[model samples]
Target: MPQAVICAYARTPFGKHRGALSGYSATELGAMAVKELLERAGIDPASGVIDQVYMGHVLQTGSGQAPARQAAMNAGLPVTTPCTSVNKVCGSSLKAAMIAATEIRAGVSRMVIAGGMESMSNAPHFVRRARRGEEVSYAALESVLVHDGLKDAYTGEAMGNAGETIAGEHSISREQSDAFAIRSHALANKAWDEGWLDKESFPVGGLERDEGIRPDSSMDSLSGLRTVFSDGGQITAGNSSQVSDGASAVLVASEEAAEEHGLPVLARIIDYATSGVESHRVMSAPIPTVRNLLKRNGMSMDDIDILEHNEAFAAASCAIQMVLGVSEDRPSDIPIPFRNPCTVLVRVRLAISGAPDQLSR
Candidate 1:
């Protein structure tokens, strides 16, 4: 019975781009989340039980050597702890936790830490001429910060532009997309006001709550905004994911190890999986991923109670909804860093285990 189990989870409140978290390095932000995870697990930082650290990140420009290692060190973990950095774009942190679960299932490591951190504002611009080895010429400094998330590798299309493409391909209208955005913001605002996020969120960089939700957002305003990616595009700032800064983390271990450490089982990691899509439709990979997960687990979309969609683009979520036939599910499109699946897993337990009081938030 030594299967992988999640014992504790925590996340820093998401900050806006160039907002509260802009000045800190990714390692520093990750360290705070890691420390909180250890605290929630009731395990000492110096405990040798932690076998490794895995962190996901996208904007790694100017982030120092072995970023995860640095984050663990900064969190007061022993230098002997191994660390690995993963970059799978939007799915980075989610995949990192899945990999940790596999390690626990394989019995290679009992206790491990997995999470992700991102600081879009702090991502550095680079001097490309230095790398190209030009002898003498006035050259412009290019920024990976700008290009990394913006440009797709296969077609050089910006993520927003691709969102527009998906929108056009799927025939998702501006009204429908705007409705999703408005509802997402409303739910986030309600969650913040009701303090549903307090258990999982802690203050970082002087920010105590999610900084991205627009409290005054309305359909009228969203309808008026011009599309930035293409002239006739349906995608706009209102309908796309807010560029954000924050981190989320969880402590995972085998079931036997959890008993050994006297830790409560927050959730069990089950049947982690992934799938691919056509190169051009990369944003919609979650459709096949959800289908494969359900099929292998011998379940259907109707068997599920809740689905939390990380908001990347309204179009992607809408398209996936149409494909997966889960459009009727209650809205749980939590923001990325503050709303990692580790917390979702825990919430699922609370919601289903008759803990109504706890699930009310």
Candidate 2:
């Protein structure tokens, strides 16, 4: 029997600050959402309804004493509920949800909670060895580049300067990059206006609203912004999502379990697939990922009714859509894509703030 989606919820207004949400640890954020989800569904957190918790975190600021278990403990769930954390780059949380669903479907678990949390604001900045030790500094003082230290893994020249290389290699034009940034704010604003986001959003203590939304933006206003990657590079701060503090979680259960609990489900996770692309070209994964997923399910692009492509980089997104043959026409300021031969749909809704470098970082 197929597993059922008991319920799904995501908290953490995607933004760049830790202000009101500051004090809470990553485990705390996950726990808060997990608890809220159970309470809203009128389920007891400590009940056996949840058999496990799967969380996703990119940067661990040493908050969790066993992050997954910490989240479950914080949520007041049963101590016996096994928990774990998963990291799949940007796909962290989404993959976590899929894994929980798989467990329920396989009869290994009756119910599970899965999601991801990233608090980039709380992500600590590390000081290099030379900064921490005078001996290392003195040894390096004798020669330039003599520390024999590993450089930024991405660029081999420092992470910040690597954006220029990517921009040049990708041929991302200045105007095109800015236009993408503008579209993100506009589409995100539109999503809020349409109430499309209300379905998944759970209000956290600090964020009743997503801080990423920018209304006072215009192409002209963005034109004068300075580039951070290089002298003539296109990337800028306004074109990316902020270093945010938030978490999202969803519940899954076996079909029998959901029926017994009388839980309402959202969408079914029919299948999930991922791939390894050139790490620098990480954005390329969605293309192959979706292709593999559809292939495994015996489905095609035409079968999807909606898509939520994480707008990591505008150029990458544009490339993926073009590769998939997705075309959109914006009229009356409404953007709709050609979903299939028979119908038109919106392929992606953009949301951004900082430079394209933000994606790689």
lDDT of each: 0.74, 0.58
lDDT of candidate 1 at residue 188, scale 0 to 100? 73
> What C-alpha lDDT, on a 0 to 100 scale, does residue 236 get in candidate 2?
65
Lowest lDDT 10-mer window, candidate 2?
A: 336-345
Query: Can you write out model 2's per-residue Cα lDDT over 163-269, one digit (the tens) per residue?
Result: 34444555656676567667767776776777756655666775665665666667787788887656776656665444456676777777777778887554455
In candidate 2, which residue pairs get closer than 3 Å at backbone N, Cα or C atoms, i.e. clash?
15-244, 237-354, 238-353, 240-353, 240-354, 241-353
Extract clashing residue pairs from model 1: none
Every model: Cα RMSD to truth: 3.4, 8.7
Which segments of candidate 1 are over 4 A away from where they belong? 131-139, 329-331, 334-361
| Quality of model 1 by C-alpha lDDT | 0.74
